[model samples]
Target: MSEMVSHSYPRVALIGECMIELQQHANGTLKQSFGGDTLNTAVYLSRLLGSAAQVDYVTALGDDSFSDAMCQVWTDEGIGLSRVQRLPGRLPGLYCIQTDASGERRFLYWRNEAAVRECFTTPAAEPVLAALPDYDVLYFSGITLAVLGETGRARLLSTLGDARDRGARVVFDNNYRPRLWRSVEQARQAYRAVMHEVDLALLTEEDEQALFDYSDGEQILQTYRAMGVSEVVVKRGAQSCLVSVDDRRYEVPAHTVQKVIDTTAAGDSFSAAYLARRLRGGSPKDAADAGHQLASLVIQHPGALIPRSVMPV
Candidate 1:
């Protein structure tokens, strides 16, 4: 394999929403916080990359107090919010998580009216969409696409095409949620519309099976490769991750955990660390190792954003 090549201080824009997160404790108390698929990735990416690359979050939030707090947390994490839009008379969405004895999580959402749904619909979003092509990498997930609605998804697709034309890499994570879409066919159409423009795909094995009903791992890889994606990583919980770069493939085992306090953000942290390593000139194998390492530590914690102190050096 060739040595890793870094992009030298590249700009990354992660597009998604951050919601009010509540964790129901065993004592029947609720602990409030914030989390989202891409937002969790943004936070972990910022922590891993530090000042090496410019990491910005692109999403719309309400002018409410929760939005204010979320922005502050991002700022503290060294994630840029210059592209974050503050919509008026709107409120961010909320969700509560219930964990089973095995630390597996189930979420209940109240996000039909999230401010981020208008992220690309409002008049102010025009400039933001116009500016997206300026970044070196643009990252988003399935959840990000789901909340955008039809009009917003159309706008995002055009923006992605434009961005790729300007040499920006488009990264996508297949974080599928069946409840978010009207129909499976609708989701498939939306995914297919943008797949051709994707540069790197960070996919989960279960999500691929659940969404497209792929028979096995090979089918998933073949589908993405056929879409012209140059890089693909298939994450399987507690199993080895499969990586395909061009014509070559590699299997990197995940880090084992003794106990899992919570299973949330495992994939998000994995994607973040993987991207961070790649941007720093690490090989695909090294990046996958880093991903598994971070994810291992994350699942041992209670929340999405674990304390920075426990971070691996």
Candidate 2:
């Protein structure tokens, strides 16, 4: 649980919302695509950090044609759409998914007036929240604070406290939905207001037992190391994947899928190969074994992406 140097390229960004999917099937056909959970972890962290890193995805889209094929599939998966935004008569936001017989899934949304709920509250989001504090990693989730309501989550918590006061490295991904919040104490006060500008959380022990009901996984890793979050990571889908990292703890193990068929972006491709193997330096148990070997090859494939030549080398 050490090695995390990272910075030969690192620029990442990933805010949220990128809907327009459909899926359905069971003989009642459908299947269009383009997912969300932080755009499926920004298309698997731009196909696992292809040029070392510079992911970029922010959000807000419209000028239809499914927002120009979701910006030509994030510009053919190299991501970096210079912080996308498009608004005008707005659109982007829709869902469907259905999957039964074990691959478990069931959404249905239509996104309350999407266009990323005014992505950071327009005025062209004040230069995309002032160039997102010059990113070096700044992911987003908990369904991006339940679709950035309260004025785009107070301008994304003041651009995540000025991108962690310049040292950047926010990263968080609880993913909880609870019918897009309005209670559960307003999603635990918007997840304790960004858990003190989180520095790598990636949680999901059933979304910390349905948002802070804490059914002890060491009390959700000592409540995200008592809210200072110095690398937490819980995951736990098909068992083992703990990794605390600052007071050291580990767990790992999870890759025995004989068949899954589609658990829709299994934890967004295991938080994109555990943040592309911890931004390439690897070692939080080798980035949770490259996030359980790319979420056991993305739930044996179906949607939420999986086919950049069946990656994983």
Candidate 3:
């Protein structure tokens, strides 16, 4: 691993969906854009890594206007699209975000038929999975698992085992939304089944308590360690993030901002920079620092994918 592109660099792939997001304006208008957890991470990581790392997105989408815009956006951000699949008849998901006067946002989803839902189980995914093991790092999230459904989930689990066996490091972020699953127990089992294969786990303390009902942050870290994740980051909004790597723990303080326009993707961006830095051979503390630096700016933005100009250069 090398921090500089002139040296060696790693190829990292983020697997998930990108949806057409509508942020309703105060005047009853919709500000349309694209975003999702792993997509946000992919964009942020590409910005953070620049040419030093090869950041690609692995997912399936329909041949529609929204999907076209997404592909263009990824290309503009320098994300490789060699693994993206465009399936016929199927389409990307859409979500609307409505905010109150105080800037609290509410979401409504329409993703039951999204193409990425069957991305893993389709014949097209075979080549993608085969190529995945060659990458240095593979990233996915809880939403990805939930959306993949039963058959896709089973296929993904097997692919992950093969990827891990082939030396590809797996990274997971626990972004738990109750609406995505039928029951908490179902999500818990899915998370536990995949946790052992993860090399790094980016967790939000609040989400952990919601999903697994951990007693404390210590329990969260201990539990992830038991799951065989050597590196675990516990994030709490506006507070310090606790990172456990190897046998050492570091309390990395987050930057304070005057206000948070929207807290969306704060953890996603943090995970991207943290993994990007770590993949570049930067120290764990340095990676944590980079994570916080990127996340601080993200919290100040109005959406999940912020203006690229504001991103760290």
In the predicted model 1, the residue pairs found to clash are none
Predicted candidate 3 versus true structure: per-residue lDDT over 63-126, tens digit per residue = 8888988999999999999999999888999999998888677899999999998788888888
lDDT of 1 by residue, 161-223 (tens): 999888888999999999999999999999889889898899999999999999877888888
Give the CA lDDT, 0 to 100, for residue 256 in model 1.
Answer: 80
Q: List the residue pairs that clash in candidate 2.
A: 141-144
In terms of lDDT, which candidate is strongest?
1
lDDT of each: 0.91, 0.84, 0.87
Q: State the lDDT at 78 in candidate 2.
A: 87
| Candidate 2 CA-lDDT value | 0.84
* Over 4 Å off, model 2: 1-13, 24-26, 29-34, 42-58, 61-88, 93-122, 134-136, 139-165, 170-254, 263-267, 276-282, 297-313
The lowest-lDDT stretch of 10 consecutive residues in candidate 3 is 1-10
Alpha-carbon lDDT of model 1: 0.91
